[model samples]
Target: MSPCTFDGALPRALEQIRGAFAGIDFAEVRFIRDMNGRVHLVLPDSADQAEVVAARPHLADALGAYSPGSETGLVRLSDTFFGAALMDEPFLVQDINGTLIRLIERRVVGQDWALAPGTEAGASVAHPPRVSFFSLKGGVGRSTALFLWGRELAAQGKRVLLLDLDLEAPGLGAQLLPDDARPEFGVVDWLAEDLVGSPMAEAMLVERMLVARSPLADSGYLYVAPATGKRTAQHPAGFIAKLARAYLDNDRGGGEDFAVRVRRLLGTLERDLEPDLVLIDSRAGLHETAAAAILHLDADVLLFATDQPTVWEGYRYLLAQLAQMAHIHPAGDDDWRLRLKMVYARASEKQGALEGFRSRAYELWLDGLYDEQPAGGAEDAFSFAETDDAAPHYPLQILNDPRFEQFNPLEHLSTVGAAAIASSFGPFMAALDERVLGNEDLKAVDHAD
Candidate 1:
């Protein structure tokens, strides 16, 4: 008999339960994962109590010490307060070997990271549209692209607000704002203060000290809400302590998670700045907090990548997690997945590079985000062909240029002149303009307050 462990518990229980219940018509079987990552079985009310009793010895042998405190290694759904209504809840399907099992996850942390945000289809949004620049790995020029675009928009006399959400490895403050121009407080300060119910964490404070105007945008307003501010720099010792508290949910304020808090923060900034566009710089890779920027912000997510094996492998993990989202929340008239787009950053000038990248992206999307279309081809199915230019897998290409290498808009503005910037980022900027500014449909989506 195998000793009880987190990974072994599920298969063992499933085998034993199936062996006992053979041809029984059980309504449902739920395997709940506790905080400790232990598996707990919840049999439906339809399960015969007598059969359960008779199978107790066999179940015990399978479950061992991790039997969820049950002698029989199972609990009837009817025994809990959740009762019959629990059956109505949408439980995620988990594949164990070849068998499918319904799973109810009870997590102490990272729940928001796992679950996708709920979006209202075709809802009218009155506020300015938000766009998030994300990459699986750093040094992909995600932030540089955001800065250039925001500056471009500002040059065209449009107000642009850039928020730095890469809290752990904060650079936007130093990148955008000079030492003298750095804001008194920034996003991290607000989050930490708000967590403690500090009076300083008010909307007025965000408007006054959390935002700083950058010299990069000379024509129009270019506001930045960096990850850290001057105060953090001055008190470097306390920065980590504040950062540790920043990601925590506001339990006292009715359980507002990290995503909700960020949303509120964005709303407050929007209300104050009234920017024409909001560009967010998300933390690189699959950091838990990246979920807030990607899914929760209702932003048009541009997944930045290069044609590299490591990039695809990292994306596979992310897309697999997102695939779960695609399954659990069925697509509506306007699918939320449609908001996701690919950005082939630092793309090679080689003839086959773009095609190769697109092919790999299409395969990843098909395996993950894209819906399964029928052979007959339903008109409204979310799936797309490989050649479809409008598909999420179809990347907006940003070519490899030495001029933009180690780029800093503030410092290397002369090296990457207008012509160089245009040549390198022209296609990407044009597409982004059309998507964010020209697309009235995208701007009109409904978002909750």
Candidate 2:
């Protein structure tokens, strides 16, 4: 059916389509800026108006953005952003299936969500929800954080999959796959062979992942998808124009037919892996690879920061650049801000700074609230900048213990679990571990007798 949202003015609604698909990829985007402006965007290899409209609600829901009706993709907003007259429409197409297939997800209304800043009154608290630890800055300890947190969850018996999306820099492989252990194939190899759809598959792929013995080893399962680290050495002349080249290309880096290949990989993981939680330690930083992961990957984001001011500053700076890539927000019932679990490392030595920060943060927030509402109850408090005015801005669980200082909490947090991790990262990680992994349904993946 023609998008249910359209009123039969296909030519009229084209200009506004560009803004809606700002993050989507297209081959040729030519705009006719005339009386009847048309936004003609040629898809990479696959997509069509049907796919875009069908997936609009799903995309909106997944991104936690402004939700639209089923035919949302058909509606567009004027570039002017002038309140009302800015709505336009455009058509979408698919030359190939993007890594993320747009689908309609049904949500019930029995529960409602509200997103309000400062009030902190609305929103749901989702713990143990999947988070892909990512960094715009590589070597920022994304994998390490993923492993530690996974171990924390595994210890609680919550099934977890440490899905490795770092196709190029495969850290988990080095961490899990031992030098002596040999396997005939890896995820990249299997993917290249398109072995996933087969019914009679041999040896489970997750089982094949290199496992590092940890007190938190999850019986739940942690699979590592090893990237080939394979860079196509050469691009054939006019590969894009060659229809035959489509299936053969896997690298999406301006050359390979990445969308199809990636979708296959994601599909395999989603179905075959069958994990309760998937923690993707994404490829370091903001590349096309990372963009795809961020926009399409189904998980909240856990951004890491070291206690070092430089680390925090660098990350904060890069966050602005990343903002343009996707709808970034922390997970929460009503507010997305909560979904962003900020991990401040080396909190032990930074106690003074942390205290100062919280104190200032509280005061600042109070002031802002007061500004927004002159009669606001927090007027006397001075907002987040002053601790006195803040609503107990969650304490900076200092990871003060020297064991954690060295970045090795396993020894300190072993069987003792919670108490051990708290020694370094403050009570933060341990508390998070408890909050996410200690649900009634979870019984300790690693601690299971």
Candidate 3:
């Protein structure tokens, strides 16, 4: 098949190949898409190349491409071959139903997504307060909450940078930027251009990517590094291609991994804009971008959750993975646990709703975060209980408000007014100010109705 046809045709090909090779015991099968977008099927060394070539007709029919005498686009799965081609890794893995793939791409920085033993310990603690807003599932108003909180901070005369890391479903740019104010370049553009060794200097890239929001300018600076470039059909052409290329590692020059580049990107923003707080709108669910924000960036993570079974289950998996990391590198002076806080979004003030949600969150935190102590023993000074007011796992509630139901920062700012927004999110903002930002004197503004 042509490269264009192979763009999104992996599932059908996997099903057909599985059916064709049924009952044959193969060690491993890999699906690789090369730089030119051509798809290749990889098999273990034990498989006969001639057999694979003989099955070319079936493979071609499955792939919807007939490239004769091309060895059926088959390659041996080996370290050397894997290293030579600049291709995406772990495209699909074999499962009972043929091949299973995540709806969103997952990127791992190092081996098996685990950091080195001393990496976390050596992380810089002097950077500006970086806060990540995350949710296991969407529609919890994660990004909305971030926009409101960021505006509140800026209004309090604190410089803030709202970063849109949700590249797949970007909305912050539209939500915050006016038609004339949108940046010419965005995070994806910078990464893609850098990958291709563009001559644009770092200063120029920052100038074009970080655009200031005029609405918040009078209070304090609020700059946004949106996910995509200006909202025009002509601009950001080949967005999917740019996204695919952006995720690739810088193996040639700086040799920085994707996570490192992201960190550096934030660092550049912080340095250039000199924002007091950098609030990142992390991608929802378990994605590479989300992992980079949560695991690599030395940021205070505010995990947003609603009272739902699916949300809890997803959080359970995420926390369990984090718990393993905590176990591997037990809490030290600068541990990541110190930076985590839970936010219960869309919380109702009904008799038991808040408590019930808090209870479930506490249980998850206990299982996935808090280090267990010996039974009937004196607890460490820092040991956390479900009810501890000072514990990072404590749930900060954002009471339900109809005004925020259909939240749009630009529209709501004028309609609902900042006072109402602040009042609705009073407790959450207070907790964030006290715990994360270390701003005790600053309070949310109370505009008169």
Question: What does candidate 1's lDDT look like per residue over 273-347, in tens digits?
Answer: 788789999989887889888888878999999888999999998887777656554445457788899999999
- For model 3, residues 1-449, the per-residue Cα lDDT tens digits are 44326444566556555675675443356655444444566666565666666665666555654222246365554533444242333222223344342211233433224442226432564578889998887778888888877877887877788888888788788788775677777777778877766765374454555455646445766778887756333555689888887777776554766667777778777776777788998888887557777877888888898888988899888776565456334445555677778888998889988778878888887777676667785534235767776666678889888888767766666788767776778878877888776645564433221
Quote the lDDT for 268 in model 2: 54
Q: Which candidate, 2 or 3, has the higher TM-score?
A: 3
Across 145-232, the per-residue lDDT of candidate 2 in tens digits comes to 6776676555555666665666555556556544343233444444444422342123334444322233336454544454421221
Candidate 1 segments whose C-alpha is farther than 4 A from its true place: 1-17, 22-28, 53-73, 81-91, 95-100, 119-126, 203-207, 328-333, 439-449
The TM-score, computed over Cα atoms with residue i paired to residue i, of candidate 2 is: 0.49
lDDT, model 2, position 294? 45
Indicate the residue-level lDDT of 7 in model 1. Answer: 71
lDDT of 2 at 12: 25
TM-score, per-candidate, Cα-based = 0.88, 0.49, 0.71
Q: RMSD to the native, candidate 3?
A: 9.6
Q: Estimate candidate 2's alpha-carbon lDDT, on a 0 to 1 scale.
A: 0.41
